[model samples]
Target: IHVNISAEIIKCPQFVRALTIAIVIVCSKPNHSYEDFFDHVHVKLLTCYIRSEPLPEPEIQAREVQCLYGIQIMSAALEHPGGMVLRLFHKLYQDSVISKESFELWKKEDEFKAGFDEDLETKTMAVVVLISFFLSLA
Candidate 1:
């Protein structure tokens, strides 16, 4: 979830710090259940973003923020139980944050393969690893 903070945003140190704090809180591994942590983080993020002054294009900024949130959710899914993860994925898929077709391909890589293949596994694992690393940092 690499966010490209525009130059306009970068100039505002307070906003940047607030946004950074929000991101950190949202991505952090909580001492409590992930569900509770996620709920708290979600509410905090929405409140912070909503009350802030509008960006040049609020819709686009909102979409970028939503996409980042989706990635954070996906990271949580990977670290938790598979059932929990799949449920999150399903919800995001329905919301169109995650493409259903891409997920289906991820689900069917082995079955769809014409022959023995390492590439699919490698790619999938890489994504998992990268997300996990970021989540850890958060």
Candidate 2:
């Protein structure tokens, strides 16, 4: 989990590589159940720092790939304890991390503003996925 958080929050390429390698390793272990692995491995998180300069194409592709991986694992992570799933969803939405149908629901809810503002991170791994793709081709 710390690794996931660090990869998302910290804009370092090294951390992204480490997190990607870690994710691939976790997914490769057939013995581990999705939920159990998620709980233990902590497959969660993202935060986008608005930047003036664009990232290199390779790095952008890498980020997009990471986000894709996060999207694949997100649903299962939500099934676990704590509000990780919802938190991730909100983070993703707030940061425009991913395009989700339910974002309309968030906009309709009165509590969304307060909740979104208070939370520092949005789990919009999907948004990252989308952003990465755009950046890669830029």
Candidate 3:
């Protein structure tokens, strides 16, 4: 929807790729509840981030785990802008669909704290902006 199917947003290629993965997972399951969608999307991303040859670490790529949670929030926000972002986040929290740990993890991430560091090339500044507006209901 941002452009052609293979297109990546120029400013944040890594984040855009991550966003695309989130969007695809959502589009593939329109009727899935947030819980079900979360479980399903998480597995899909693990496949992309993990390798069979050798295990990277025991953390299960915690950064991606939190960002996976973040993109779902971001996607819903984009789909329905305005205060809907906060509202959806609250509902997700109340329902226990998203955990408090994920919120904290996202906030601590370097991309969230360090501003738009082109050096990292992740450039997930949008998530940082969203976090600043966050209410921290947890």
Candidate 4:
């Protein structure tokens, strides 16, 4: 899960590409779930940033943590069903784990991309579960 990215590219574009490649390599490792991979990357990236520069403003750190939790919850919800997921999503939105606008956009996009009638209850449950998971992490 701990990915080491090193490159000679100094240009921003090339650096981004290299970073992406590093992430891909880490994520593609066997026997690791996406959530675990993400956690590892987040911890490493945050640690590096903290060590190399001024610490993030408290608000920024809080927001980043929220975002990470939101992602984790979303992944969890995708694997289960119930009203809990929906409630969790709503809570995250309210708590600013995800911006409301972004959540709406994601919801719309997901609906469109579903390609069929997905169960409303299930979708709601997934969101709730994801939100709950995020809060728990926080």
The numbered model that scores best in TM-score is: 3
lDDT of 1 by residue, 20-49 (tens): 345434555645343333344544453444
Best first by TM-score, ranked:
3, 1, 4, 2
Q: CA lDDT, every prediction?
A: 0.41, 0.38, 0.43, 0.40
TM-score of 4: 0.29
What RMSD value applies to candidate 2? 14.9
lDDT of 4 by residue, 1-138 (tens): 224443322221223223333443445444544433434444455334323334335433433333333333433434542342344344444444344444444443433121234445544545554564445545
- Model 4 misplaced regions, further than 4 Å: 1-25, 29-32, 35-42, 56-59, 62-127, 134-138
- Candidate 2 lDDT, 63-130, residue by residue in tens: 54344334334333443323333444444444554344333322223321211232212334333334
Per-residue error at 117 for model 3, in Å? Answer: 7.8
Give the RMSD in angstroms, all C-alphas superposed, for model 3: 9.0
**Model 1 shows how many backbone clashes?**
0
lDDT for model 1: 0.41
Please give, for residues 1-138, the per-residue lDDT of candidate 3 as tens digits.
336444323222244335435654564444544443334454444344332224343333443344444454455444533433344445445545445665556455554322323322232433544564455543
* TM-score of every candidate: 0.30, 0.26, 0.35, 0.29
Q: Who is ahead in lDDT, 2 or 4?
A: 4
